[model samples]
Target: MSKQLVVYISATGTTRRVAQNLAKAIDADLAEIVPAPPFTAQDIDWTDPTSRASRQHADRAMRPPISASPSVDGYDEIFVGYPLWWDTAPREVRTWLESHDFTGKTITTFATSSSSTRGALGEQLHDSAPDAHWVNGRRFAANASEAELKAWADSIA
Candidate 1:
């Protein structure tokens, strides 16, 4: 079996937990895609749609900086985790995806969201990395079971 890597960008900690669960199941390396400066509570103002962060997201140009870049070489399978924002991925995820090369590798995505469907996020990932063999995306509640996530990861492998 080829080595696997789980890369995640989390906002509310839900995605981070999911990523860790999946990584443990597959014995994969876990890499957190932390934004350079990090987002403050004020920057996430989900309550105020007129906030700067919200406005930048509305314009589809909210590219938050990343603190570290993950190495994709030697990993045949990559599992990416994130929270669904604005019916898609967070801007930092875009930065991470664009920063790496996944040629000839299998890419899987999982997301956690309160309202949005996983299909939308999966489609967005497919669009972003057209050459990648994107698999079905999964959605779980904030308090999902570790066994459930492990089973899902095993099925994909």
Candidate 2:
């Protein structure tokens, strides 16, 4: 059985790359946090205020619907990853977390960012899965290497 699970949401494939590398490094299961309708390029355009991504970021209470929640029954460690949007995770991640029961699991977060750090993600996402144990999360560059990802995973473990 896989002890670790790596789940991520990547609108433009950046975070998906990181999550895939991390899962391979740790020999974990992988899952994608897919949006119900799936995002188009125009919907994720950061420069457009009317974009779906922009509207979700502007409203803190928003929880964008996910197509399906991943099952977390046997994993001891769960890694949640996403692209850093407005210094936090996309709201769809929150919806994914809220959909699962992670009372005894260790929840760790990671993000892909161009320049911003993954700021206070555990604190920001606490209410969604308040019962799980959360560890400090890291932000990585788009081209972060396999060695770097393994090292980070070792340190966190």
The top-ranked prediction according to lDDT is 2
Would you list the C-alpha lDDT of every candidate in the order shown? 0.77, 0.87
**What is the model-wide C-alpha lDDT for candidate 2?**
0.87
- lDDT (10s digit) by residue, model 2, range 7-92: 99898999999999999988899999899889889877889999887998889899888886788999989999988777788899
Candidate 2's displacement at residue 40, Å, is 1.7
- Which residue pairs show collisions in model 1? none
Reference-based TM-score of each model: 0.87, 0.94
Question: Which stretches of candidate 2 lie above 4 Å from their native place?
Answer: 118-121
Please list the Cα RMSD from the true structure of every candidate, rounded to 1 decimal place: 2.0, 1.6
